[model samples]
Target: MTGIKDVARAVDMSTATVSRALRGLPGVSDETRVRVMETARRLGYVPSPGAAALASGKTRTVAVVVPFVTRWFFAAVVEGAEEVLRDRGYDLLLYNLGGDEAARHRVFETSLLTKRVDAVLVLSLKPSPDELIRLDHLGRPVTVVGADVPGWATVRIDDEQAARHATDHLLDLGHRRIAYVGGAVEGVLDFTAPAARLAGYRAAIEAVGIAPDAALEADGSFTVAGGVRAGHRLLSAPERPTAIFAGSDEMAFGVLRAARELGLRVPEDLSVIGIDDHEMSVIFDLTTIAQPVREQGRIAAQQVLAALTAQYWVPEQVVLPTRLVVRRTTAPPSDG
Candidate 1:
């Protein structure tokens, strides 16, 4: 079988340089990385992973746990995470909770532990107090995305801040009567994002010396359909709010649809702000606070690898940043 030495000979580089390049170590430069890969491909060289693991005490694998792979946000996170992982010579093992609570328990109880991975990366899988403690027993490195996990490290956006920014944008646009649309329990412990964001919205309103009306806060599912339902509930009331802060971009799109159905024009009849900056947000011209979802995923994987490799330790909490992207969907509310 072709080996690193043969590839090194073909590339006219030292075997040690070839080895480091192939292993994705930092000492290798971009040119050397390319040269090693080209040489390996041309020579049909495949490294023995099992032997490598035995020598290095690393499987070169990481496990990712998430629920509801169908959502655009989660999928984006995975895509961003996968690119970084593959580039680092690390393979990914994916587990989807598939929206089943029983399946969730089984995964935490079984699948995550038995893996030959050097680290574990989780996206919004709400491990219970017990489950979190149990997961720590795996004795592998740990990192999380989108929510808090005390013992392990995390990479996430400031959910409350993101929500507050969205709310504050409406306030800046002179929207005193802004309403909020958010999600209820979806059986995912990782689903605390919405609730925290709701708190942010209320805090913003209270800071302005305005009483937060419970009637103006509506909850439903986290999909477009759910947004439509919650939109109706908020807008149909006798004292309808002139602006809306949706927890997700999907929910914001639903509010847009609801406005049209009710003969209301966006920013003309009602201004809307949302979080996540969903793909449709740009096309729909919706204003939003964009969370670095994909970046968070990539960083989460990197943090896990750092933990496993003992390179450096970051803070227990790694908070990703967010910024507001304004578009045509939001404007100062009409006095009429």
Candidate 2:
């Protein structure tokens, strides 16, 4: 069987140097590290995980905690993170909560991940006070995506600004009777995006001298079916809105479906805008605020790698930019 010693010999480096390079430890020159990695690969050397962990006091594994794996956003982030981890010689362990509150509580309240992972990457969850204390006690590096937490690295877009942009687009098109479809302010999972986006929508309308109306806002629950229900409710009201701003592309798709069923012409009769620019958004020709979802994941993974490899590293809060993508779905409201 191939071993580190064999790799060291083939690369003409000492066993210690080979080990450090393979483990992605500091103090090795980049050129030497590359040569050592190439030699190890050519020699088909695979280090024993158990032995390595014992020697280095690190499992060289990162655990990614997510609400669920089926969603496009979560899956994209994981894919980007996994690519970075693989390139850096780390293994990824996924802890999917499957959107169950009980499952989420158990994962955060226990030491299930303490010794198994070198670091953790949490996605889209705002940890509670108790959960924060438990995570702090873990003594492991934790980086979060889509939520800002003190004393930890965070990577996310400005959701409020994105929503404001979406709302502003409709307002710019002279639509005063605008409606909002979004997740509840207080959801079971306690996600950060919904509230921020809702705030943005309110801020934009208020800036235009339009008082925020409770009747115009509906909880879409960040899902297609929820958006459809919200859409029907707003459209069926005595005073229907001329435009709708959905918090997510999936919900926007639902709103579009609802409009079709109600025999409303998009852009001409009921303009719509959404966030996330999901892959399916193009099929619907939906205008949206596009965020770099996969890039956020990749950056978060890199932050974890930095914390693991550097002798001294400070946590940072990285906020990426979002942009408005124009499409066929948004236009000035018709004079009915």
Candidate 3:
């Protein structure tokens, strides 16, 4: 059986140096670390798990906590984070809170405390002050994606800015009677995103010399079905909006269906835009504000890895950018 001793001898280094290099500890130069790893691979050397654990005090695993695995954004983020963790010789432990308050409480109170993970990456789930306190007590490195938390590393796009940009696109297209289809202010998960987007939409409308009309707003619940319902409500109104900005691409799809059912031609009859250029965006030709959801996950994972490797790590807030993507769904309103 290949051992650390054989690898040490082949690399002409002390066993301590070889061990440090293999486990990615600080005492070795990058060049030496690379050489030791290469030799270990060639010799097919495997370190004893017990010995490795004793030396590094690490489990070589990361926990990823998310609200819903079925959502495209959450799934994409997980895929990106998993890719990074896998490449770094780490295992991922997924904890789905299932949008249940009980499940969420249990995860923060018990499941996480018992897990042997080196770090944690939280996706789109905002922790309450009490939950944050529990997390701090765990003493594990944590990185968050999709929302900003004090004293934790985070990766997120500027939600308000992204929404404002989406709204601005419609405003620029001569759209004044604009409507918003988004999550309800109180009931939705990821509470910060929906609120911020709504604020942005309002800000843009106000900046264009128009007061935001409550009648023009509808709650889409951030889903296709919700969008369908909201779309119907908005379109059936006595005074329908000329343009609608949906909080998500899925909701925008619902709006499109509603329009088709009403015999309203997209752009010609009702210009629509959405956030999150989902995979089906191309097929639907929906104009949207695109955020790098997968990339945010990858970067958050990277920050977790960095924290694990560093002797002292400071929490960072990384804000990525979003851009408007023009497609066939948006245009000047027919009345213009």
Candidate 4:
């Protein structure tokens, strides 16, 4: 059978307007409504239960947009959210922003504008301020995971402060000259982890009254391979740093591998610290900033569900605290 979307297409009206027209609801012009109903009846268009529920006020579903599903952080968030959403009888419609900037833009500007979902839960998307405002006006609640969106309720970690704390851990161990290994995936602008971490690293150096070394900045790709390439470049410098602060545990693992290849001793020759306590962080003894990724996911889903269920939930930015996890990867500078 034909659908409201088909009828909407036939009459060149929105599915929402078509739905209102079919259900005899107010807000649509009588002429347009007549055209939509006529098109639907003549074309044998049948609205699905989900659309009907929407017209009647219910769906038990939320739309989740994420930058990447393969990434450990994003995957962890989804796993956590899935568990919560599934338990509460809420359906999740996951939209993957497949590692492409253009694809992400299309997903945000077009795909998410659908009327199928009840609420929205966005993962680490930093849309332009204008786009975010437009989303706010879409008449449904929104929740952000892994970062803050000014007007919506956000469940995330204190990324900047966590990075700063990680830097302090390295500094406390007597390492003064340090290089940064930042995991900045190419293409997505929604997440500002790299910028925030860089700020924290700079802030920490300034707090200790050490001049920031612009030469020590190296971009890693949030993978072991990316870290290895970055590590080689940073290590090959004329003035190699005695310590490295990697933006992620995965990148830090790469640095460790590179150090081993170059016959450098861990903590004795160079110290390394990273953010995100990946499962392997402990196995590799990587000192890191540990944030509860899964917990953030669960909380974000709860916020979305609350919005759908008409429960009282204040839209506020909730930053979960992070702690510095001390491991064997850090030590006093040997020359000191």
Task: State model 1's lDDT.
Answer: 0.83
How much is the lDDT of residue 128 in candidate 3? 81
Q: Could you give me the TM-score of model 3 versus the true structure?
A: 0.87
Candidate 1 local lDDT, 228-312, one digit each (tens): 9988888888888899999999999998888888888888989998998888889999999988888888888777767766767
Candidate 2 local lDDT, 144-201, one digit each (tens): 9999887779999999999999999999989999999998788668889989999999
Instruction: Report how far off residue 84 is in candidate 1 (Å).
Output: 0.8
**In model 2, where do residues sit more than 4 Å from their true spots?**
5-17, 27-39
Candidate 3, lDDT over the whole model = 0.89
Could you tell me every candidate's TM-score relative to the true structure? 0.85, 0.92, 0.87, 0.81
| Cα-based lDDT for every prediction | 0.83, 0.92, 0.89, 0.82
- What is residue 302's positional error in candidate 3, in angstroms? 1.2
Model 4 local distance difference test score: 0.82
Candidate 4: the clashing residue pairs are 126-190
Encode model 4's per-residue lDDT on 217-332: one tens digit a residue. 88887778989999999888878899999988989999999999988899899999999899889799888899899998899888877776565767878899898888898988
How close to the true structure is residue 153 of candidate 1, measured as C-alpha lDDT? 84
Ranking by TM-score: 2, 3, 1, 4
